[model samples]
Target: MGCSRPGAVAIVSVFLAGALAMISLVLPYWSKMEIVTAAGEKIEVALGLWGACTSVHPPALDTLTAPVIANGSEVIAIEPESALSDSFTCGSFYDDERVRISCTSFRELANGQCKRREFRGPASLCDVATTASFLGDSTAVVPDATVSDWLSVVDNACHGIGHTAVALAVLSAISASLCGLLLFVGITCGAIESRLGRVGGYCAFATATLQLALAVLWTAEAHPIRYTEHAFATSFYLNAVSILLHAAAFVAAQRHQSLEKEALAAMDLDGGIHADGAATEDKEKAMGSSKATELVAV
Candidate 1:
């Protein structure tokens, strides 16, 4: 057979990696965090490529516990004693495919005496729908052109990078699928042709490279602040695993190509020797026939 067990295993890895990537895309576990609000309410958040979900729990039992509020741009205080396993009401938010920007905006209301800071975090669709119309409307509170321009620049950059990362991830999945098809053909044929093997290896490498870029873009643009207790979840880890698998597939394809070349060289050398031996034997037979004819004629 042209393909060895290692090459077959490599092909399987590509398909497996593709499956993981698909799962990662569908899952909403790219980032997870459990936080406690200043009002003693515990909220658990999970973010994904397409959407996010939140679980809210009732306030802590200990009413005497002093609540600590963070006025700055930092993570809310989390109660160390709180357990994530606790039951709570879970709701989906920002289910739209577009990236969401969670921010806190401070605006001066018509009443000069009251300056209010509005925080927009991950919330259920219902909660978001019920928010005040002017809550997230940037036009409603643009203090000046400079601030508005800065906000626009930041928002556009975030959206661009986030969408690009998602597109790369989808492309990587397609690349992985193509690589898997090439690998299947190679294995079934009992040897991967040099050209086909090269193509397959390139595809695998492309998949890995795309995955790496996806991760970088996601972290740079979509990742929330770590101070908010946010950490990578299973979906991100699955993507990392898929990258490793693609790299392994690329290495296996190279090895298969080398083996194929060596096999072809060996076959060519043996065929050449057999051809030379047959020619020599034919020459000897012709010479013997001529000598016998001369003897008979004489």
Candidate 2:
């Protein structure tokens, strides 16, 4: 058969690894970054598998990443402390999927203070409902005039890199699953000695090991650049754990093969010893009979 008891255990381990890898892909297994705005307000946000959720909107079932706060389309205060006696509304426009700012303005007022304005131009992912209102100044749109951009820039520096990381995570999970399956098939086949079965097992083990190494290497590469403001979520770790389990199974299978070979060699040695002992006994008996005949002749 393909495997003895140890081989069976390896098969189980591979299956577990594959199952966990698939689960990791679906779970919200990335980091939640709590970005603090100028007003010392903590904005909780998570990105990757479950999508992007910002503390700006409450967690929702519909979007992968929704705003935490429910104040739809409100001003994201870049300069929350700056007094707005004459801070007129700046016009906004979409630059690709993201909105761009041309100037600044107030949207709402309470107690003679600006309470809401436009976070008006944020990324597509963060276009969640805000309480930001228009500055009602259509004349504020500037054409080719040279004007300094307002301080209303949202901190989405990690966003572009985060998307790249997402793709990597997905690919890693898929590769891991495939390798795990190969390992499983190799261990469960009763025809362990068959060329196909042996090839399957070896290929599975090699692929899994290589994938694990590559995943770690890629994570290291992304760490300094991407995760400076973020972190790895539970799902990422789970995926790594799956890869580790495959390694464990590979080790187990190797040990089992070693022991099997040792047993066969020992058995052959024992048979040879027994045969030699029988030959020696037959020779001794023949010699004794000849000596007796010679004695009788004397």
Candidate 3:
């Protein structure tokens, strides 16, 4: 192929790199989560796989029995009815209190102070719902309606310069720079008709595309209101896929350059033979001239 053929590879590489950059920036925003407060306020939360751990927990001992307090001071003890109802699991905890309430917010009593409640058996002390609202008129009853504010807190934390966000930023910058370099190499190879360069360009393009896709997928799967297990799994899978694509592309580019060099060497050898044949003809002509001169002189 002519040197210009590699131009296509360069073009592809650049397009891929641009895509990667766009996705890297977009994914974070897409995966953002928001918490809606009981007062109808919305708080945006940015969370990754690590943040999921804090939101999910093991269920309290009594899943069915709601905490009952007497006169704002006495904690009630329940008799062990059955192990089936008391035993808690991670999913159970997520479903019961953890999913519905913010970990930082404590349940407030009628006097607007945080209420302290005890658990019977091996129950979690953090199970009491902390979120509350003013009752209609003047009566204070713990509203059955509880709001989950974890998303808000998580969003607020993520919005700040946190470890996860900072790490992501650093990773994205590095990947972007590497991608740009690969594209430049591919372009240079195209100019020289280097087979390896074309190949490298192709590889760079492929990797950039994959990286961008992963970022997009991660952002798309994140929800502002709800937390699901599938979101976490999808995020991890996307990241893995991106990494694999990046590696594969890099290898392909390198191999392409190697092949190009071999082809170039072969061409040079063929040209050298033609030049050697011309030199041989010139030598024969000179020898013939000397013999003719000697014969005439004799």
Give the best candidate by lDDT: 1
| Displacement of the residue 92 alpha carbon in candidate 1, Å | 7.8
Candidate 1 residue pairs in backbone clash: 2-190, 2-191
Ranked candidates, highest lDDT first: 1, 2, 3
lDDT of 3: 0.41
Give the per-residue Cα lDDT of candidate 3 at 168. Answer: 56
lDDT by residue (55-168, candidate 1, tens digit) is 555454543464433558643433442321233222233332223322121121122323223344344232423221112223233223323332332243336765676678
Per-residue lDDT for 158-230 in model 2, tens only? 3454444446556656555665565466556544433433443454466466546545543543344232245
TM-score: the better of candidates 1 and 2: 1
The lDDT for every candidate, in the order shown, is 0.61, 0.47, 0.41
lDDT of 3 by residue, 268-298 (tens): 9999999999999999999999999999999
The candidate with the higher lDDT, 2 or 3, is 2
Regions more than 4 Å wrong, model 2? 26-28, 37-43, 49-182, 191-214, 217-229, 281-298
Clashes of each: 2, 27, 9
